[model samples]
Target: MADIDFGDAPAWVAVVLAGGAFVISLLARRDSKKSAGAAVEAVTEARRASDAGVRSAVAAEESLALQRQEAAARQATEAEAARPRASLALHWQGGQIFHLVNEGTAPAENLQLLTVSDDAEPLEPFTRLGVGEVAEFLIMTSLASGAPTALEFAWDGQEDPVRLRVPRSG
Candidate 1:
């Protein structure tokens, strides 16, 4: 190689170049730190969004459960309203006089009283018994047997007979 001298200008140029390189390195390092911080912020934001999504799903499930429970309760109430009910009670007014009272919401049609013993006479059937109405009948039971312990009765729209216990006479 042939030695060539550039009269002290080469030394100054080398020093300037080295300073530029140092400044460039510092800027690069600053930009790298900013990028790392941005990456960490993005990860944190993603985690928060995931937690929110899980909470929303749980809330939706709870709302659906409440709706189902309300629907079931409404169906149960409707079924109870559709069922037929009979409320007939026997009341003893005096010695042989007894009254059958209709205390239900619906009317009792073709009301018939059944006799459990052979000695008792069958009472006349009622065509229709309205709500809050009463039907009087005479029960000719022997003094030894008193009144029938229980009286079985049937009415229209009822599939089974309802047995009512008779209160003993004083």
Candidate 2:
């Protein structure tokens, strides 16, 4: 074997080297834990930002949907409140009350009924009735609020009248 020179290193050199190695290992472990913590925090922050964006987008869509519904409801109310002139009548019999008939060559379809001034209303619901089908409406004595209860039944291009009393129980 070739001779190995110690280069003035003493027997204690092994202990010094072991001590240095232990100190270096502790420092490396601490640095690694810090780096891992930083990585986790970064991921958490990114997730929170993504969630916030999604929530904002959902809120905007909901607001728009509500606005659309409100506009549609307002438009329907205006149309129903202002129709052309037509009226119907109220007839009573037994405990069962029904409507008078409104028929013509060009009568309307499922009538859009409304309260007339006190002397007119349609009194039937006709299916696909062309030019002479009858329309019916009900007027119970108990359901009348206006002094003179009147009804107006209107359809595609036709209108009629009937006077109905207010219903009481039903």
Candidate 3:
């Protein structure tokens, strides 16, 4: 057994402890820098996710608007197809003769001619005027005090009478 005595043991111990503390502080600082970097990366990724969510919402709204427009266009086309189209015109053919012609896709049923005069009798040439069909009528302009400027006519299933301008004799 050897007996040893050191007079400066406490000083050596304090120096060693200070060296160990310095090393530990350096390690802690490195760990803190790494944690800060990770936090920044997490925040950046969250911002990207939020931007993508906003873009998705905008795209969804645009798609919904397009769908509504398409639906409206489809409804308009359907209404146009279902509605009836019947048109009539009056033309002068010299010598006080007039022609009533149907220039429409659908037939005009129960056709009746009307005039502005209250006492004037309504003239009906045909029960049904087919498409592109013509009916002739005589107008006694010499006997009447005033020639009709416009002629009104109506048919079955019509809501209102249609007025047609009478062509002037040249």
Residues 1-170 of candidate 3: C-alpha lDDT, one tens digit per residue: 03333566777687789999999999999999999999999999999999999999999999999999999999999998887777898889987899989898889999888765786887754699888999888877656466788888999877799989889898
Residue pairs in clash, model 1: none
lDDT of each: 0.85, 0.57, 0.86
Question: Which portions of model 2 show Cα errors greater than 4 Å?
Answer: 1-29, 82-161, 164-170
With candidate 2 superimposed using the best TM-score fit, by how many Å does residue 115's alpha carbon deviate from the native? 18
Model 1 vs. true fold: TM: 0.57
Q: Rank by TM-score, descending?
A: 3, 1, 2
Clashes of 2: 36
| Cα distance off (Å), candidate 1, residue 143 | 4.4
Q: Model 3 residue 64 lDDT?
A: 100
- Identify the runs in model 1 with alpha carbons over 4 angstroms from their true place: 1-48, 51-55, 71-86, 109-127, 154-163
What is candidate 1's local distance difference test score? Answer: 0.85
User: In model 1, where is the ten-residue run with the lowest total lDDT?
Assistant: 1-10
The local lDDT score (0 to 100) that residue 142 gets in candidate 2 is 41
Ranking by lDDT: 3, 1, 2
